[model samples]
Target: MLSRTPKMLLQTPGARRGFHSIMSSLVPMVLEQSPRGERVFDIYSRLLKERIVFVHGPVNDDMASLVTAQLLFLESENPDKDVYMYINSPGGIVSSGLAIYDTMQYIQPKVNTLCMGQAASMGSLLLAGGAPGCRSALPNARIMIHQPSGGAQGMASDIAIQAEEIIKLRTRLNGLYASHTGKPLKVIEQAMDRDLFMDPREAQEFGIVDSIIANRKAPQSSGKQ
Candidate 1:
């Protein structure tokens, strides 16, 4: 029985001002309530012996941190089990996104990404971070990659620092794209610069995605297997 009512205690004046503080304390519980929690609870309730974990939702620092912790836990407890990642997000902060991607890569889990809606920008990068043979996207869903952009403010030196940061970000972005798609770095950079949005079919054609989940067919070998 999940509580649908917003907790009024979280809405009080003092609570409002310290909302972040209080939320930080409750973040663990909220994150567990996300897809991961449901999967764990289901396994326990059904008394199943197999391992299955679902990591899904909007990309944010807090959520990434939570998922990272869970991934670490899984690696320690059940290192051989395949971890399913269901991604549906418009993406978030660059650092947060990269942190999640790095964490996933560190675990080296067999991650199957079932995109129910959209996996755009950083979300796409995270999906690509999965083990080579385990990455995937649903047929009706979309995956988009583009140049990273952010806002900055400060003095002349500060502006120069921000410009440098953007250049580095773009370089990293291009590297990720080239590694995943096996396309020429310049070609991937051009597509990202042009803000390409790819459907599952187009992604497969471009070698950005390994296989299409259409017609209820099983995933094809990604050449890594």
Candidate 2:
């Protein structure tokens, strides 16, 4: 379902040492389960009811559709509230992540992304789209950024067209990262030329993340979104 039941929401277990780590492991599975079991206190159920969206697997067309729909729904329902997105994907198709990233940018509300596990490749591109100061990752989470690639074969003309398209795609990706991180396009391009694996600390230092999530407590933030 694109929308969650309003009554099905549950509060997240507040900060305990290693709470994020624990949730990081369990949430992806828990959130997938239906409301058959105890639904009231179900963390996953609650997350859906709130403004939380989970990206637990690959970023493909299906994944992209779900996230974009949820973000659009959340923004329409409450334009002032923030949208909390947790990503734990190995990454997938470039255009899939781009759709979600574009949706996040188009929304009036601030979209916050949490790297709970492996946010690599196209996943990092999605993470980079979060509104300023809203991008964060768990202390032990891993993040990566890299150039996009694809293959094509047919006539020589087809191969040439594919090559030109890939080049354009790389340039677009470079511009996206540079705009988000305030880094030079050359710097972002160099980092992406090879797979760049980073922990939360390095990701923050590299401008991929703005904060290291210490806790989940939120007290009605507003304005500067």
Index of the highest-TM-score prediction: 2
For each candidate, the alpha-carbon lDDT, in order, equals: 0.63, 0.75
Q: Candidate 2 lDDT (Cα, whole model)?
A: 0.75
Q: What is the number of residue pairs that collide in model 1?
A: 0
Candidate 2 residue-wise lDDT at 141: 90
lDDT of 1 by residue, 127-203 (tens): 66667656667778887777876555556676677777778888987898788778899998888885577887777
Single out the weakest 10-residue window by summed lDDT for candidate 2.
Answer: 6-15
Off by over 4 Å in 1: 1-57, 215-217, 220-225
lDDT of 1 at 167: 80
User: Against the hidden reference, what TM-scores do the models get?
Assistant: 0.73, 0.77
Kindly provide the TM-score of model 1 when superposed on the true structure, using C-alpha atoms.
0.73
| Range of the 10 consecutive residues with the lowest summed lDDT in candidate 1 | 6-15
Give a tens-digit lDDT track for model 2, residues 9-104. Answer: 001112122223444574443334466754334576577678999877766666678788989999899999999999877777777778899999
Best by lDDT: 2
Clashes of 2: 2
